[model samples]
Target: MAARERLADDPSITFPGFFDDTAVQTDADGGVVELTGALLRAVEVAADDFLGPQDANTLCVDRHESHRYRVVRRQGIIFIRIDEDPRACGLTVPALHSGAQYAIGSDGRILRRLRDGEPDGSLAPTDAGSGIPVPTSEVGRSFEAPDGAVPLPF
Candidate 1:
């Protein structure tokens, strides 16, 4: 795609997989970030469609302005760095593997809890916090596992 045409997608903002053959980089705060293996796989699958063959498969993440978060590609996978202290939401990075599938949605809190389960050391996820609670208005949000999967509306 031409640069001018691409710019029309969203100028002043670059996203992961924006380029087909370039390593994505983000400059943000250093903090602890976590995700389940499932989520990582989903993202990987998603990238395969947008990124070119020469592009390295990875999502580099860093802090964003106003306490918001951003995701990018690096080393053949996608990543998001959670703020130690979140503003709108109390979302801490959930410890997850880099090889499983996950569901990403606007309601990250609900999705994270569902995918990561509770930190209390339990095998099965708890129903209380199992389902992530996202605003119905964000129902149109789409997501994919780090495995370069297709976009699924949540």
Candidate 2:
């Protein structure tokens, strides 16, 4: 039966808290517990498992204040990208990354990193579309960033 098959495939899952170097207060006696480096790393590993396979196309987090962050997987990997106005100093940039280990900055700058044993600057952006993936503001028309900004290819 389809239901039987689904149940068979589903496995038990556990979730680890994702708070590194974060302090926790104990209700009893107002005790404070601080997560150190090792504990933090362990938490990260455990959190990864709970978050599901890295190959998952999407990962979302919703908070109490209606603040939500969605980490979408493009191919496999995900990077924390920070983007902001190039001229702004105190910028509240969003961290968005594709599975390619690359990021898009709020300032419209693209960030890429090379893997181990490889040259850092050797990475190149092949034109997935007709041309490069930069937004254009010509003819004085309303516009948004180029489609390249999206994780999914157009």
Candidate 3:
């Protein structure tokens, strides 16, 4: 069976086969997808779609100027944290000023969303002073995409 099919059938695996596509090439040594050109653009588009609409009234601030993201697979789930690109914002000190985070299932379904610093109420409280709580399961919360939705490759 294909790797994608095997991943889909294995409930123990949480990382989606989102990057299994013709446009993406995987490195044999580490099995890491080399995202470039069209594939990179597609992933960006997917992230934007997942983020939904933003307020357009800001004067000179471009909310979509750039984004820095971190992806991790742990305990049978994939978590992604996206923050505003500090370098592009020209900040004197490095920091993640604003952004959104979410967890996705192997089926490419978004399980939960944590906007800004607020955690979804269903999440269990972490250790004291650990900041926002981590998601423990699929909460059924999902973003409704428009006509053309791009599949995320991570």
Q: All models: lDDT?
A: 0.33, 0.30, 0.49
- What is the TM-score (0 to 1) of candidate 3? 0.40
User: In candidate 1, residue 98 scores what lDDT?
Assistant: 17
Please, what is the TM-score per model? 0.21, 0.18, 0.40
- lDDT by residue (tens digit), candidate 3, 54-81: 5776322245545655655555456556
Model 1, 74-136: lDDT tens per residue?
Answer: 443333322212332344452242111122333221122111132322234557755887899
Query: Which residue ranges in model 1 land beyond 4 Å of their true spot?
Result: 1-27, 55-154
Specify the poorest-scoring 10-residue window by lDDT in model 2: 6-15
- Residue 150 error for model 3, in Å? 61
**Residue pairs that clash (backbone atoms under 3 angstroms), model 2:** 77-99, 81-95, 83-105, 83-106, 84-106
Q: Answer with 2 or 3, whichever has the higher TM-score.
A: 3
Q: Counting only residues 3 or more apart in sequence or on different chains, how many pairs clash (N, Cα, C under 3 Å) in candidate 1?
A: 37
